[model samples]
Target: WDAAYERELQTFEDIGDTGEIWFGEESMVRIIRWLERHKVPLDSSVLDIGTGNGVLLVELAKSGYMNLTGIDYSPSAIQLSERVREKEGMSNIKLKVEDFLAPSAELSGFDICIDKGTLDAISLDPDDAVGKRKQYVRSLSSVLKPEGFFLITSCNWTKEELLSEFGEGFEILEELPTPKFCFGGRIGNSVTALVFQRKKAKPSILDKLD
Candidate 1:
């Protein structure tokens, strides 16, 4: 993916900040508007996993979201994201080079976790995709505050699949609308947006035993 991004950046340096905003601008707008409609606090602490060039973080910052952090596995991606941050004059945002599937100790207790096409990229890996995705979910759950929001945008999975994957650990809050483009009467959007809240910890039977 990094190599592909490098090639893409070479071709579209004028257009792309770092060749990672594959979801397009329309989807970004829709998700941001949906968050506003749902009354997500602008001051909420946010973590954008697989942040790419940090386009999502930039958009959130432009929308007045203060506590912003972005993480990417690729060092080059983080470098480009940092460039974007500097160019945009956004000082409050933090950019880190880290793997979301195994995040660092410093990433924890965030009020909102945003996964925009990150899981889709993981699913594209043919080797152990299911196991890896499960690991990703576990790692994400670890960093989020109890009952914090997990907003995900994916083109690879439907709303049903997302809910199924996260239902064990979260409560489904809502499914945001996706723009439809029809081909041969098959009606569906290329992407899906799902909002979920991390489930609060349940009391264990061992508590009574203790």
Candidate 2:
């Protein structure tokens, strides 16, 4: 990603000629619509994980969302995002060089988090992919407030696979419709869009006794 961003790509799609799967703008529209449908306040804190070019953050800000933060581990990526944010005159939208699998303390307590292909990219790691994925879940869980919403879009994982991955500390809230294609006389979605809500912790036996 650092190397990719160093190429000075203007948009996330331009990073790797991945416009087909990197539908940041379309995903933003769907995400905003879903948030509106779920009654998420405009002032609610929103974090965009792996915000490559930060276009999604800019769109969210333009849509009246006041508190927005975007993070990417690659410094080059953050730099590009900062440039994009500044170019759009969206100074209020914060851009940080931080890894989602090992986020900073300031990254916590967000009301909502948006992941667009970040997890899919993470899962492609050659070393300890399972461990890294587990860490990704842990880090995400730590940052989100109780009952916070997580909206994820993936072309790599199926809806059922994502549900299973996030099932432990999250519950399915809704699944947004994505573009579909027909192959072998069967229709299937090309992307999976899922909304999950963090589960409130249950009182332990000791807490109950207390």
Candidate 3:
């Protein structure tokens, strides 16, 4: 993944075609729209894990989100992301070179998190993929505060798969509908976006008395 992202940064540096915007602008825009429609707090801290070129951060900045952060394992990706921010004259978003699976202590207490395609990449990895995925999800959960919202967009997994994967501490809020096409009398969407919220702890009787 690091090598692939380094090549992506090189490609962007050499020619200026940043494939960083993974799926499409439309998909990103749709999520932004959903957040707006739901009146998601703009001041809430947002962490974009696996943020490649910081395109999503820039978009969130444009949408007036003040507390924004992005992390990627690739140093070149972080450099490109920083360059993109500089070019856009945006200083609000923090871009860090860090792995989500082994995040630093500083990468916690976020109120909202967004995953574009990082989960898909992890799922496709050949070595110990399941264990890595579990770690990734745990890391993600740790970084987010209780009741924090998580939005995930993927072309690799269906709604059922995503729902099954994230369940212990996360509750599915809704799955954003995607444009569907009829294939052999069956409907299918090429991509899926699901919103989840971390479940808050229930107060025990003793705690409630206090």
Candidate 4:
């Protein structure tokens, strides 16, 4: 990511210092409500991929869930994230500097995997779109246990579009647009948010047909 974009990602560096772009209380409330509907609790282990500056991880930590970890490709973002964790005195949320697209042993064993802007970033390049998306899904499956949940938030995809692409091995639990009132800027643009559980059962009759 470019320095400018990195700046945009960290635009909320105040960590609640001012009118910034960090996940606000209302947005967090909505997220928590969805989590309750999905039964995600403090016991859940979550992986926040592309966790630039780790705000979401920090927010999750504040919610009393300690089993949280975050990864981002940008070194700058990782540095800022670590600083935030330290400043907040949150010892349990692990932040790492790694490109999630690359194959690595460092990623595995999480009950929930999240993508906020990561998918949107990848989808911008049409040539690399399909390949990168495949890599993301495969790695997510590898890291998450059977029946693990993937919660993705993207401005680029509609809820139906995400399901059509990533739904083969997962069951959609909640798929919907985010409320416009909770974000910065005009906020009229649509957002696709989905929570899908990995399916453990075999392909059933469909496998034989293929």
Candidate 5:
């Protein structure tokens, strides 16, 4: 991508309401709770696609996970993540500025894939919606090992919307919504969290081409 095009990606610099932005949303907390309940091995490798601000990955680090890799497209975000990692003295989590649809060689062979609002944002773009979803899903399928988990958290989409897009190829372990908070009698689902296990083994290059 050109410099002009790269400038358009939403980064931490572009984020408004700095005061409102926080890592510990209720849904994310719930996600952590669920993960704790499931309790995968500590040795498992994790991939964080579109890891915004690197907050979720940092949370994973705090949980004692060693093999965490993050990929995001924004250069500014990448720089910010590196700084945070360095400042936090984090040695295990590797962050890369990369398009989600384009898998870096370093990205493959992960046991867990976590996406926080990445696929939801891509689906909102009308022009590239279909193609982007397809490519992203394909790359995810390629990178994830069999029996891997793809955990997604989204505020914009309901559980049904996610199921509609990606039900057939994987098994949905959980489909739950964030708790509703009522102020003046208007309450809505604040977020939807879903985790799916990749059933098929990562396809070979020949399998992918065919």
Candidate 6:
């Protein structure tokens, strides 16, 4: 991402023909519609995990969301996000340089969290990929408010894989439809978009006694 931003590219596709944003504007439209359908308030606090260029944050701001925060582990990514935010005249959106896998008290209490391709990138790490993925889930669970909404978009994992990954702390709210292709007379989607609600913690025996 640092290398990508150094080239002054606006979107992920601008860096190369990666076609990560192949869903195009329809992705953003679906996200907004889902939030509205769930009755998420316009003033709800939103955190965009691994917000590469902060494009999603800018779009949410334009759609009337008031409190928006974007974070990226790469310094260059945050710098690019800042530039984009400024260019769009969205000074109120917060951009931070922070690793999502690392624990941070300041990153907590978000009403909504969105992840786009971040988990897929993390899963590619050569060093302790399983440990890192677990850490990612823990960090995300800590930051999001109880019963908050978490929307994730991925091109790598199948719906079943994603459900297994997040099953412990979240429950499925909805699965948004994505473009499908027929392969060998079977239909499959290239992308998976899911909305999950954080599960409220159950009281321990000691707490129940109180």
| CA RMSD per model (angstroms) | 2.2, 3.0, 1.8, 5.3, 5.4, 3.1
Those runs of model 1 whose alpha carbons end farther than 4 Å from true positions after fitting are 7-20, 206-210
Query: Best lDDT goes to which candidate?
Result: 3
Q: Write the per-residue lDDT of candidate 6 for residues 92-193, one digit (tens) a residue.
A: 999999999995789999999999889998999999999999999899899999999999999989999999999999999989999999999999999999
Model 4 RMSD in angstroms = 5.3
Model 2 per-residue lDDT tens digits across residues 50-132? 98878888888998999999999999888877777777899999988897888888889999999999999999999999999
Q: Give a tens-digit lDDT track for model 1, residues 1-210.
A: 677655644544566445557578876787689778879899889999888878888899999899999998988677777777887899899999888888888899999998888899899889999999999989988999999988899999998888889978899988888788999989988889888999998879998688
Reference-based TM-score of each model: 0.90, 0.92, 0.92, 0.80, 0.79, 0.92
Model 5: how far residue 133 lies from native, Å? 1.4
What TM-score should be assigned to candidate 2?
0.92
How does each model score on lDDT? 0.85, 0.87, 0.89, 0.74, 0.74, 0.86
Better of 2 and 3 by lDDT: 3
What is the lDDT for 111 in model 3?
92
- In terms of lDDT, the poorest run of 10 residues in model 3 is 11-20
Compute the lDDT of residue 144 as modeled in candidate 3. 94
> For candidate 1, what is the total of clashing residue pairs?
0
Q: Is candidate 1 or candidate 2 better by lDDT?
A: 2
Give the lDDT of residue 93 in candidate 5: 85
The positional error of residue 203 in candidate 2, measured at the CA in angstroms, is 1.2
| TM-score of model 5 (CA atoms) | 0.79
Candidate 2 has its poorest 10 consecutive residues by lDDT at 12-21
Q: Candidate 5 vs. truth: CA RMSD?
A: 5.4
Q: Candidate 3: misplaced stretches above 4 Å?
A: 203-210
Pick the winner on lDDT between candidates 2 and 4. Answer: 2
TM-score, candidate number 6: 0.92
